[model samples]
Each structure stands twice: as C-alpha cells, then as structure tokens.
Target: MARPQYILQPVNPYFIAFSLAAAFLLNLLPWGKLPGIPDFVALVLLFWNIHQPRKVGMGIAFFLGLLMDVHNASLLGEHALAYTLLSYGAITIHRRVLWMSLGVQAFAVMPVLVGTQLVPFVTRLLMGASFPGWDYLVSGFVAAVLWPIASVVLLLPQRRPVDPDDTRPI
Candidate 1:
C-alpha cells in the first residue's frame, strides 16, 4: 500500500504579516472585553508560531504584545511577557503538535494558552488588582474551541498546488 504524501507549500511573509495585523485589529475590537471572547492576537500568533516557526517567533510576539498592552492600557510588559512565553511554548512543540489531529492539537496547545492567560492573571494579582474571576478562563477555553477552525482557515494559504506529473512523492 502506498503511504499518503504531504505536499508542502511555501509560505508568503506578507500573508503572515497581514493575518497578524488583522488579528491585532480584531483584538482592538470591544468584543475582547466580553466574558468568552479569546485573545485573537494571541490565537493568531500561536497559529503562525506553530506552523511557521521560522517566520513567527518570540520577537514578533513580543512586539505585538507590546502593541496590545498599549491598546489595552494595561501594564506595559504584561502582554509582552505572556505572548513571549506563548511563542516559546508554541515553537517548542510545534513539530510534535502539528502531526496530531485538530482535537489533539487543541489539547496540546493548552499549556501555551494557559501561559498566555496566566501571566496577566498573575501580574494583576501581584499588583493588588482585583481577581478577574473564573470568567477569565473562558477566553482560554474559547481559544481551544476555536483551534480547529483557526487551523483550517490559516492553512488555506499553505495548501500546496497539485502536481499533475508526480503520482508518488519521495
């Protein structure tokens, strides 16, 4: 029996930049202040970091996080710290994680999402800020749930074109 062949597509840097920008803009929307809306910027960042480690990494995540912190009017380094950690986690297990099914991928990324959420929570707690309650966790859950969809959507551009002549790929 012939094994399945995976066609690898070349990723365009512009597409990545555009998606991250869109995610940042989405994060700027008021929906994030709601109970269940996940951090869109973090989500997009993780997606790219996992699938395109060479293209997206801690530096990009940190910069975006700083932008988010400024936009959110929160402590300057809070989001930067969280996103940097998240990016590190994503890149750490990206190869292993992407080989699994979407459901498994969702579960695999929980640690990264937790880190992203936990940093801000811990920072606020240490700063004597009031507890945000369990509702804050809802965003992580929501990001997990959205993983499959985000994965599929973001992968669209990475789908390789069919090669008519090549029946079996080495």
Candidate 2:
C-alpha cells in the first residue's frame, strides 16, 4: 500500500502566535542554562518556516533573537543574526524538506540547527569570551532530535480528520 497523504487545513495565525509565545516562555525557564536543553523557540521557528514560510519569516526570527539576546544579557545582535540566518536557511530548503521522511528530515535540519548555535558561539569567541566547550553545540543536535516531535505537535492543529464518509474515501 502507498503511504497516506494528508491535506492539512490552512494554519491559524493565532495558533502560530501561541506556539511562538509558548516556546519563548519555555526558553525563559531556568533549566535553559543546562547543556542539551534544546532551544524551543528555534525549533518552533524552524517548524513554521518549513511549513508556513510566508506566515513566519525572518522578521519574526530576528525579533525573537533580539529578545533572547536581552534575556541572556549577551551581545545584542548575536542571536538575532543566528536566528535570522536559520530562518533564511529553513525557508530556502522548505520545499525539499517537506518530501522527506521524519528521520530524513531530522538529518536535513541538523546542519541548520547546528549552525544556529555556531553563530552565537563564534560571535562570543570573536569578542574574546572564553571557550564554552563543544557542549555548547549540544542543543542544536537536541533540537534536531526534537524536530520529528515538534513537527507532529505543531502540525496537530492543521491535521485533517481521518474519518471518511462513503462519498469521500480519504
């Protein structure tokens, strides 16, 4: 049998806002400083970038990045630059990504996710901050691991009903 295809409904803007806000709030939690804690906002932003590029563009990523900079008390544009580039990369490959299996998709996004972490990391190093060690890059991989889960959860709102009537054998 062929794999089932889903025709998702149009995404609601309000749901998008709520997911972004929730991700930011999750980032605000204290556990965020720990290594391997995925960047929830980055994950959410990338999800929307892939699935709804027109709806969530680089502007929103930049804004969230700025907010993160303020919250982390780091270089003002560090995260802004990283997130904006992440958004750009996601949007660029969104079409190709949509066709992949969840496992393949995770690998596809790994580079983008890791690069998002690298931007801030290299920025800090250039500014003379001490090395944070390789662990600093762990979150990116963690975020990639969460990609499949994030895809499922975020797409929940748009998933069409599986129920089929005789006239519509979906």
Candidate 3:
C-alpha cells in the first residue's frame, strides 16, 4: 500500500468568508437582552483560532472587533482592544489547546471569553457609564457555551482527509 501523502495546505478562502458572514449575521441578530445567544463572532473566532491560527489572527480579530464596535455604536477602541488581547491569548494557547479534548478546550476558552467581554465592561465603567449590570456578562457565558458547537462545525470539513493519489488522471 502506498503511504498517504500529507500536504500542508493553504487556508480556504470560503471558510474565512463563511465564518465572517456568520459572525456578522450573528452580530446583527436581534438578541435584545437575551442570555443564550452571545457574540457569535467571538465564538467563531475562537474556533478559527485553534483550527487556523496562522490565517486568522489578531488582524482579523481587530477588524471584526472594530466592525462590532461600529455596529453597536460603543466606544471606538473598546472591542478592538478586547479582540486584540483575545487573539493574542488564543495564539498563545493554540498548540496546547489543539491537542486537548473538545470539552477541555471549551472550558479553557470560557475565561478568555469572559475576559474579552469584561474589557468593554470595565471600559464603560471607567468612561463613567452607569454599571451595565450582570446581564452584560451573559454574552460571555453564551460565547463559551457556543464554542464547542462552533468548533465542531468549523472542523467538520477538515475531518475527511483528501486522497492525493486519487488526483492522478485516469
């Protein structure tokens, strides 16, 4: 039997576009005061962080975070700072987290999610906005909860290995 040839492939543009669209859609969803559906963009970003860290890193995170900031009409650097920091954290643990079980990865991401949200929360506080209440933290919990699902979804396509030999013309 011929040995399976493994190739280091470039990142798929489709996945990047799809993930970005999903993120934007989720951001636009009317989740007014809801506790379950937090920032889907953040959840998906975490998925990509582990799966394709090189392709999607702080630059993408910063851009997406800025979009969210503009959409939400919040302070300009609020989400930007949070996302930049989150991206750095994700890259730091990408290797170790990749080898862990899904549950473990999800649990590990929980704090990062919370921390991302807290940055904006604390920023608002410092800017003299009234306390936004604990409800704000709900988004972090929701993001964490969705991490496993997002990871599974993003990884599904990559699970099936491609046959390099099959590419030869008949």
Question: Which model, 1 or 3, shows the larger lDDT?
Answer: 1
lDDT, ranked from best to worst: 2, 1, 3
* Local accuracy of candidate 1 as per-residue lDDT tens digits, 2-39: 44655668888999999999999888777745787888
Which wins on lDDT, candidate 2 or candidate 3? 2
- What is the TM-score of candidate 1? 0.90
Q: Model 3 segments beyond 4 Å from truth?
A: 1-11, 161-170
Cα lDDT tens digits, model 2, 60-117, are 9999999999999999999999999999999999999999999999999999999999
Residue 164, model 3, lDDT: 44
In candidate 2, where is summed lDDT lowest over 10 consecutive residues? 161-170
Q: Put down candidate 3 lDDT per residue, 1-170, tens digits, no spaces.
A: 85344343555779777987888897898778765567777777777777688888999999988998999999998998898888888888889897777788878999888888899999999999999888889888878877788876776666555664676632
**Model 2 spans with C-alpha error above 4 angstroms:** 162-167
What's each prediction's TM-score?
Answer: 0.90, 0.95, 0.85
